[model samples]
Target: MKRLVITLMLIFSSIIFSQSNYEILPIKQHLNDIYIIRMLEGENIGLYSIIDSKGNLLTQTDNILISVQKNHIYLVTKDYKEGLMTTDGKWIAKIGEYNFKEKYSNMYKEAENNSEKEFFIVYINEMPRHKYGYINYKGELQIPIIYDEAENFSEGLAAVKLNNKWGYIDTEGNVKIGFNFDEAYDFKNDLALVRIDDTSFYIDKNGQKKLMKSLFREGKEKIENLGYHIGSAFEGKLKIKEKTN
Candidate 1:
């Protein structure tokens, strides 16, 4: 049991970014390079790269930004504006209308798996009204650009905010579970951990609580079958105690 748990943990860590029904977001720069984000604990945008570039890394931005397909780097201004530059310090995609006065932005520091013949750097747009969304490898809005907040993909589902509440959404941008929780976690064993009224519980992708079926459906049947007398608790516990029909 311990070994099984350890294996699952390792798999989860490996594909933490491969969100949704085990969907793998395949992105690579070239034949032998794998684009990956290696952010160490404590740093905001730590070590974004295409594996080992043989010291030919394209380091161009101050705040985690990269476009492997275009081979460009972007820097955001102190007041939340984007500035684009190349790996060797050349202006390619300049920051202007879209970046000016933008409240939310999603920045990509490096590609994933380094196989992306095409890629994009996202801006969170963190604005309450904007709530920036994600883009596909083709730079298309796979998910609607509208959301209060969006999390990384996990198990083909993502935590999205709508109407000031949170819920889960499939890759098609359809709501799977009702968005009415104070907090939510990734899916595990086909169940998602949700918090309600100071209590934490697990619910299936369909929003059914795991223990609900057993507690409500089976608890009563089991009680009746036992003749409504749960005497097992006292059985053999006391020296003089005896059980009767």
Candidate 2:
């Protein structure tokens, strides 16, 4: 009986040692010729490391979860917050500073352009109230987290809501449109639809109301003409006409 117990202890010890041994697998290859490796072990199951084709470690991280997006590697923490990193494991932004959660479907979308810097929407959890802001790839706060709600960038601007009113803000966080509309939609083809008091009308980039050439007119005339009101904009056109019997 003593011999059997000692054998069982030895087998358990070997199993623990094997589980603790690190196993590496190549997960993604970046355009910069660096490879992102996923390391699995008893203690560090979700850890990531940067490596070369020859399996040489460039950098290792145990806290931040790595995701490959385009030419960049995004670092996400356990709390669902995100940051940007280079292929060589250098940080473009520190993890958890920005609250952007990467979507698997849109992960490989074109991010940056030569004309404008790439920006991401970040969410801040402030207990009873949650706010959103914008951050560039450099981790600079382009927009402060003062908005109660926000939409992604469209046509160089984004729709934000504050105090129950929707407005538009440029990439630099400047208010290009006043916060007077009850509802606003993203701009497309230099035009957007906004609603005030129950009437919906199209607006230019400069916030000037554009007369809809469609059957629907503007203001009271629009309501009287269509026997209903325009609801919202869709793909550069206002298609939310009310159902009139």
Candidate 3:
């Protein structure tokens, strides 16, 4: 009887040991110092952890997807919600809070270029209502999810639509450009093309309209030179006639 009890205890110990032994797979390496560790085994299977090069655990998470972008880490939960965290395992923001998707366009490029200020667009999809907002790299909701549509930051400002009117907002969620245009485009060359009713015109960063006479002259010259009307004045490309010897 004593021998049987000892055998049962040994079997239980072996089972616990086997279950506790987890297989570590390196998924991503950041800054040559932090490693994104995916541990497979035991109760924390499918979970992720961060460790330094010397194997010191920095943080552990149950997020489904963990991605590194510059100094910040993006966390995606199993339920499709997204958030951000720091490399040292600090929760800049908790996961599974908001529905955020990566905007993979010029907006994303603009955000990538401005590494000093981290910002991301938050998208909310609901039946009969779709909204957008902005969140900083630290996972703080900088802009409330209330806009009908929102563009990525360009030239330190983002174009957003509210009640069918488009305007621009700064990084701090301040309205740099008032909501007055029927439509608006991203800023380029310190100016943005906006439409009021059917008339489209260019506006400077201060929301002042630029004189269209020079732009119209350039557009007409391009149309006559190229033999094709290029839609809008801003869409028109000037064709320089080469000087003949």
For all predicted structures, in order, the TM-scores are 0.43, 0.64, 0.63
Clashing pairs in 2: none
State the lDDT at 186 in candidate 2.
Answer: 92
Which one wins on lDDT? 3
Which scores better on TM-score, 1 or 3?
3
- lDDT by residue for model 2 (1-245), tens: 99999999999997676434545444534436566555565455666656655545555445355556655566654455566776555666776665663443232343343133377777888878778888776667889998988888898999999989999999999999999899999998998888999678888989998875312544557466555333233422533344331
- Model 3, 192-223: lDDT tens per residue? 88889967778889999888743785587667
Least accurate stretch of 10 residues (summed lDDT) in model 3?
A: 103-112
- What's the candidate order when arranged by decreasing lDDT? 3, 2, 1
lDDT of 1: 0.52
Local accuracy by lDDT, each model: 0.52, 0.68, 0.70
